[model samples]
Each structure stands twice: as C-alpha cells, then as structure tokens.
Target: MKRQIIDTIEQYETIIIHRHVRPDPDAYGSQMGLKALLEKNYPKKRIMAAGTHDVLLSYLAEPDCVAEEDYNGALVIVTDTANTDRIDGPYFDRGAFLLKIDHHPNEDPYGDERWVNTDASSCSEMIYTLFEEGQASSGWEMSAEAARFLFAGIVGDTGRFMFQSATEKTFEVASSLIKQNFDRTQLFADMYEVDRKILHLQGYIYQNFTIDENGAAYIKLTQEILKQFNVTVAETSDLVGSLGNVKGICAWIIFVEEDDQIRVRLRSKGPVINTLAMQYKGGGHPLASGASVYSWKEADEVIGKLQELCRNY
Candidate 1:
C-alpha cells in the first residue's frame, strides 16, 4: 500500500494535504509534516494544506492551506482520518487522485491509494516510516518545520507518550525529529498548557467525581455549568482520558450535557470500554469510546450498563 502511494507521489505534479476537522495536534501535525516533506523533495509540485485555518492557528502562522478551487489535477493526501465522513475540505474531490495515510484502528478506504496501518501509533509515524524506509525515491529529508509538525502529531496522539499506544518506535521517531533541533521543552510546555479557566473547570469537575462500588469514576457536566465555564463539548470530551489514570480508578466516564443530549466519554485500563460504549450504541478504541444519550435518565441507564461491565471485567 505504501509503495503504491509512493509511486503516485513520484508521478503527481501537484500534491495537496488534508486531515480530520477541528485540527487536533495529530491531525495538524500529519497534515503540515507531509506538506513540508512533499514540497521539500518535489519542489516542482504544487502542494497545499487544506482545512480550517482558525483551528490550525496555534501550530501554523501564515498558512498554505487552500480552497477547492486551487486544487484541480492535484494528488490529495488525507492523513489521520479514521472514517471517510470526517474528512473535511472540498478539495478532496477536486484532486486527480486520492491518497490516505492513517493509523486509526478502523480503516475505511477513502482514497485511490490508501496506506492504513492500524498497528502504527500515529499517522506521523507512518509518514516517518515512509521517508525512512518506504519506496519513495528521494526519501525527502525533514526540514525544521517538518520535524516539529511530525513531532507534534506523534506527541498529541500518544498523549506525550503516556498512552498505551506509545512504544519504542514512537520514541525512536521522536528522537529522529529531535535531531533536527526541535525545541522539545518549549513544544512540551505549549502542548500541555491549559487555560487557567479550563484548569478551574477541571478542578470543579474533579471535585464532583462520582465513584461507583466497583471503583469506576464518573462526572457529569450540566448545561448551566458548561455555560458558566464558557466551554464546549469539544473541550470536555478528552477530559475523561485524564481521569482514567487515577490510582484507585479502573475506569471512568464523563457525561457532558449539550442542547438536548448528553455526550458520554468513556475510558478504561484493564477492561475494554469500546465494548461498553458499543452497548450504548457508541464506538471507539478499546481504551476509549463515546456516545450520546437522549436524557439524564438515559445516561443513568447507560451508566448502569457500564457499571455492570466493570463488575464483570
């Protein structure tokens, strides 16, 4: 699969890159990293990064992201997208060919040339492998920009190498990127820095943590609380992942109230929370999953199922 894409890259004159929406560090990292690499090696090719510039503001300043109109007869590289529906940017359809580089567990082919290695820790790692060992002719050297972006993606997806997915290979990639003189300390500080207000909200959320008999922690954020904090569902979705690390906690769930539904974030250590989430019609990786329930009462029902699963696990 990688060789096929490398062949396409060699043949294509124009290359455009994209990723999932909302621009997490991993998505942005893979998008920016690949863009810089392609442009460095194939300088003659026209390459553009596509998607939300506002969301990419933290990682990128003056953006090369372009619109669909700018992308006729170009090769589109979609990275870090788990599913086809989540791939944003209209330029994808405008491309002459589609290529995908993703590391998510589920691989649905979105492009003519798809390189989906669920075994890889991050999409950045896949790109790193390509440049190092794949059949890409030039094996483009990583620029400072490329190194930083790729490092960010690896750090983001692996939770700064804290998640189970982080492995020896992950660190090897990080080490290689660091050799390009990336500011490791500054990047780490920037990546982990949360707003004081969000920190306070997290404190408040933690103060209200509810633990069941089986040591599963849970927190529910009401609409009024969310409004008071000026936080959206996006801000709170990843919060549960932090709670799963508590010493006494075997699993955790955060339920945030939105308009008419409750968004549930589920996480576990020894148990497979994805199955638990699936019981409520939600799905994700084994350690993490999410779902939405209609009402608070429904949320209680979902919690009951989770508790049962916890007891059994």
Candidate 2:
C-alpha cells in the first residue's frame, strides 16, 4: 500500500491535498505534513494543500486556493477525512486518481486507492509511518516542518498522549519524529496557549456545566452565550475536553449553536459514542465523535441518548 501511494505520487506532476471541513489541528497537520513531505521528496512536483482555514490552528500553514484546472491531471490525496461529504473542496473527484489515507472507520470509502488503518492513533501517525518506510525503501526526505506538523496532528488527536488511541505504535511514530530535533516544548506551548477571553470562557464552561444523575456531563453554548463571553465558535473547540476529567462522568458532550444548525462534540470515558453520533448525522472514533442537530429539541435528544449510554455503562 505504501508503494502504491508512492507510485501514485510519482505518476503525477501536480498533486492536490484535501481534508475534512471545519479543520482541526489533526486535519491541518496531516494535510500540511503530507504536502511538505511530498514537496521535500518530489521537489519538482506541484503540490497544493486545500481546505477551509482554522483560526484555532493558524500556527500551521494556511490552506491553498487550488483552481479547478490544477485538478485536471492531478492526484488527489485526502487525509484524516472519513466521508466524501465532509471533504472541503469541490475538485476532489476531478483529479486523475483519488487516494484516501485515513485512520477512521471505512464507512463511505470512495477512492481509487485507500490506505485506511483504524488501528493507527491518528492520520499523522500513519503519515509518519509512510514517510519512515518510504525513506528506507525509496529515499524520501522528512523535513523538520513536516515532522512538526505530523507531531501536532498526533498530539491533537491523541489529546497529548492522553486518549486511549495512543498505543505503542503511536509512541514509536512520535519518537521517530522527535529524533528529527523538533521543538516539542514550543509545540506544546503553542497548542496550549490561551488568551484572557478564552480563559474567561473556560471559567464560564466550568461554572455552567451540568451533570445528570446518569453521570453524563454537558455544556451548551448558544450564539448569545458566545457573544456574552466574547468568544468565537472556533474558540470553544478545546473546551469539550475540560469536562472529561470529572469523576463518575462516563459520557460528555458539548453543543454549540452554529449558523445553520447545532454542532456537537462528543466524548466518552468508556462507551461507544460514534454509533450514537451516526444516528444524529455524524460519526468518528468510538470514544470521540461528533454530530450536528437541526434544533434544540434534537440536541436534547442527543443528550438524552448519551445519558442512557452512561447509565448502561
């Protein structure tokens, strides 16, 4: 599979990288890292990273605006995305070949070639392994920037090595990147740094968070509450994790009101929440997932289902 991916890359003079919309660090990192890795090895090839911007992860490279003509004869490689509908760009199928590389469950697998591995901790980890193996077999170069980007992805998705997905192989890949002498301390600082407004919002989340008798904790952030705290929707991304450490809380969710609908981020200590997310028009890892709802009633139903999951546990 690694050889096939490399051969596909070599066959194309132009490559366009895509990921899921509403970019997270893992999405940005894997996409940017792959772009860097390909450019470092195939310096002459034209490679572009395409996606929506994420202000929370702006430290990474900005997404490129690739024209439709660029995809005419290009190879499209999508990273960290599980489904076709979530891909940010419209030119994904316009490429000569579509390659899917992800660490999510193979639900909507629609690619010419796929390297899906659910066992891998993050897509960044998979990318690191690909480059590590490719370097030994085909003499590919792994740049420091690429390493940093991959590290960010691994750390972001793994919750800084706290998530259950972080296995021994995860550490092995991380150690390989650490050997490149990237600044781990600086990366952690950049990822964790928060302004006063965000700090105040965190306080609000802590103060207003509610836990049901079933041990399902949750916080709802409406647009008015966002304005009250002077925080953007993007600023609330990291706050979901704050509810995870509370005792007796088996499942947790954060509901943020979006322009069109309600966005949900789901996390569980020991229960399958992805399946539940699927019922609500979303899916992700078993322990961590996401969903969106059309109204407050739908959001309440999701919360009710999550509460039942906690009770069953």
The Cα local distance difference test for each model comes to 0.78, 0.90
lDDT of each residue in 1-313, candidate 1, tens digit only: 5666777888878888888876677888888888888878778888788776542236343347586667777888899997778886766778888887888866576677778888788998888888785424555677887888888889888887889998898898888889997787777776656344468688887788888878777888999898888767667654666675566787888899988778888888768888777767789999888888888998888778778777887
Error of 2 at 10 (Å): 0.4
lDDT of 2 by residue, 240-289 (tens): 88887787888899999989999999999998999999998999999999
Q: Which regions of candidate 1 are displaced past 4 Å? A: 54-57, 60-65, 134-136, 195-197, 205-313
- Candidate 1 Cα lDDT to native: 0.78
* Clashing pairs for predicted structure model 2, backbone only: none
Root-mean-square deviation of candidate 1 = 6.9
Candidate no. 2 TM-score? 0.70
Which parts of model 2 are misplaced by more than 4 Å? Answer: 194-202, 205-230, 236-313
Q: Candidate 2 — worst ten consecutive residues by lDDT sum?
A: 190-199
